[model samples]
Target chain A: MLTGHRTWIYNNQPVIISTGTVGGPFEANGNIPDAFDILHDDMWLKQSSFEKAQRTMMEEAAQIAIKNSLIQKEQVKFFISGDLINQITPSNFAAKTLDIPYFGLFSACATSMESLALSAFIINGDGADYILSGTASHNAATEKQFRYPTEYGGQKPPTAQWTVTGAGCALVAKNGEGPRVTSATIGKVVDMGITDAFNMGAAMAPAAVDTIETHLRERNVDPTYYDLIITGDLGHIGREVSMDLLQKKNIDIPEEMYRDCGLTIYREGQPVLSGASGTASSAVGTYGHFLKLIKEQQVNRILVVATGSLHSPLSVQQNDSIPCIAHAVSIESGSDNQ
Target chain B: MIFFWAFVVGGTICVIGQILFDVFKLNPGVTLTIFVIAGAILDGLGLYDPLIDFAGAGASVPITNFGNQLVHGAMQEAEQHGIIGVVTGIFEVTSAGISAAIIFGVIGAIIFKPKG
Candidate 1:
């Protein structure tokens, strides 16, 4: 039900039954590598092109989710997925391979939670029995489309973020044995007139803050309700910027309780300038990493606020400022019926 | 024979770039820039023409050819118009590609949604 201005309360409490995560060599070498279901030794997973490689990752993740759930592909009623590639071809092609009814999504990097929220909405409303939702990105493919090709040798500023190479998928059902989706806060597009593509963290942070604030107020709860509040790919600069903004808004989230997927995905010495940013940034972190923590009882209740910067090569060249968005989903450890 | 040589030479150049990127772990951007600069220098020294003759489209199809063209244009104009040509002649050859990039980029932005 629509709870407030931008929040929805999933009264039926759809459950995420299983998840599949695939990561590249970079993520394999980074933090939480064990969280991934399949870790590729190379970025190109036997695909001739990086874009195809991204599609392979997406397909693999969906397959893994289905397999882990002990369900046949035919059992899945719908597939909602997306990627950072032009026109979101990766997800569409993956859907062709999966052959399930598809919903191609494009919220840039925030696609993970966007798909998740929609899947929950459908299942909660009795529209489908089971839904597969996912998002993926390849570092080289994303860089080639949005900026220069990796072979271009163009120097990127320190503010630039490395697009992650991975995919995350989850199987959501009306009744299942896993983490429950309690609430979701949809974000509005907020452009602060920042035009520099290199500084996406700064470009996306305001939208994240706006969504978080709305989620808190609408739920009639404070930051303490969640054991951890995670934001999508805000990296270092955006993380700090959001924290300051939250404090100014009288939202007191402890540093220990607040984290960013972008900062957590990679190790310190990795060449990611600011931090990681891509569809996979939050996907693998939440689906593969944090969900395991919740299942293990390491984390109880968490809020994942996935952020995305909606800008393309065309938008950047057109001198249009970056417009960003964030989508928040509240996940609890136990089933709502419990 | 010409197509064979073009394929071989082009493949070899690509192999070198691949080695630089995969084995040496060099950034792709840096590797590409190095190839472009190396091509321009080879053309400036008058050593690239033989390779162009030997490989045909192989030598000209990649970014190295673009660099060679820039030097070639600048040198021809410099001989006739002196130092001013050094500044303006390179653009005479490369302007088509650059302007096309910009024009298409703007058109694409205006026509399509940014994030979809």
Candidate 2:
């Protein structure tokens, strides 16, 4: 049911039965290496192009999710996914290979939560018994499209973010023994006139704050309600800015309770400038790392706000300021687990 | 005949880059920088001119050509205006591309709206 403006409260909580995460060599060495089901030694993954490798990563993630769920591919009712590439080619090609009823989405890095929320909505509405939702991104493929090609040797500014080369998929079902999607809050497009593409965290931070504040207000819940509140791809700058903004509004969320996926995925001394930002930033972190924690009974309830900078190469090249969006999904651990 | 030579030369250069990327696991940035510097060093030694003569556009159009142009500009200015011109003249040859990118980027940013 549509509740509290942009928020949707699911009366029939859809469960995330299983998840699959795939990462490249860089991610394999990063903080959440254990979260990945498969890790490739090279970015190419034996494919001729980085784009093809990304497609394979997404396909493998979907297959892994299905396998973990103990279900056949034919039993999955729908596949909803997206990527950072132009036209989301990786997701499209992967969908082709999966041969399931597919829905292609483009929400920049926020696609992970966007796809998951939609899949949960469908399941709660009795639209489908089982669905696959996920997002993927490749560093090389993303760099070639959004900035200079990897071969260019162009020095990026300190604020520039590293696009993650990874994919994550979750299999959502009507009934399961896992975290349940309780509600979702859709975001509004907010543009702060930030023109620098390298500093996307600043550009998208406002949108994330907007959605987060709205989600709390609509539900009449305080920020302390969730055990953890996470945001997607809000690197250092965005995270700091969001904290300041939230504080100004008297929404004092403790630092321990709030974390950004971009900040959590990588450790210090890594070459990632501002931090990680991509479709897989939130996807892999949530599906692989946080879900495992929930299964271990370490966390009870959580809120994930996926932030996306909605800008294309054409838009950036044309000197347009990035418009950003964020979507928030609430998840709770199974009562049976306790 | 000239088109065939151009295609072959360009294709070979691209293949070399691909091989470096695949075999050495070199990032595209490092590989491109190596090619450009290699072109500049060859040009300084008066070897790249012959390759340009033989390959025509193939030698002059790739990123290696940017290095060649930089060295060529610096060398010419050094002959005319001593040491100071060397630094200033490097931009003389590359200013067109840089300025066009900046100016056009600014104009585009002002005109377009970011969508999706």
True interface contacts reproduced, per candidate: 0.00, 0.00
| lDDT tens readout by residue for model 2, A1-338 | 99878899988999999999999999988988999999999888888788998999999999999999977999899999998888888899999999999999988888988998999999999999999999999998898888876755555767789988999999999997889999999888999998778889999999999999999999889999898999999999999999999988888899998988998888888999999999999999899988888888898888999999999878976778999999999888988433
Local accuracy of candidate 1 as per-residue lDDT tens digits, B2-112: 999999999989898878865664555678898988889999889789998999999988788778888988988898899999888987888888899899988976785
Residue-level lDDT for A196 in candidate 1: 81
TM-score of each: 0.78, 0.76
- Candidate 1 CA-lDDT value: 0.90
Cα RMSD for candidates in order: 10.8, 12.7
Q: Which pairs in model 1 have colliding backbones? A: A151-B28, A152-B29, A153-B29, A153-B30
Task: Give the whole-model CA lDDT for all candidates, comma-separated.
Answer: 0.90, 0.89
lDDT of 1 at B112: 58
Question: What residue runs in model 2 are displaced by over 4 Å at the alpha carbon?
Answer: A336-338, B1-116
For candidate 1, the iRMS in Å is 11.5
State which docking tier applies to candidate 2: incorrect
Question: What range of 10 consecutive residues in model 1 chain A has the weakest lDDT sum?
Answer: A148-157
- Candidate 2 chain A least-lDDT 10 residues: A148-157
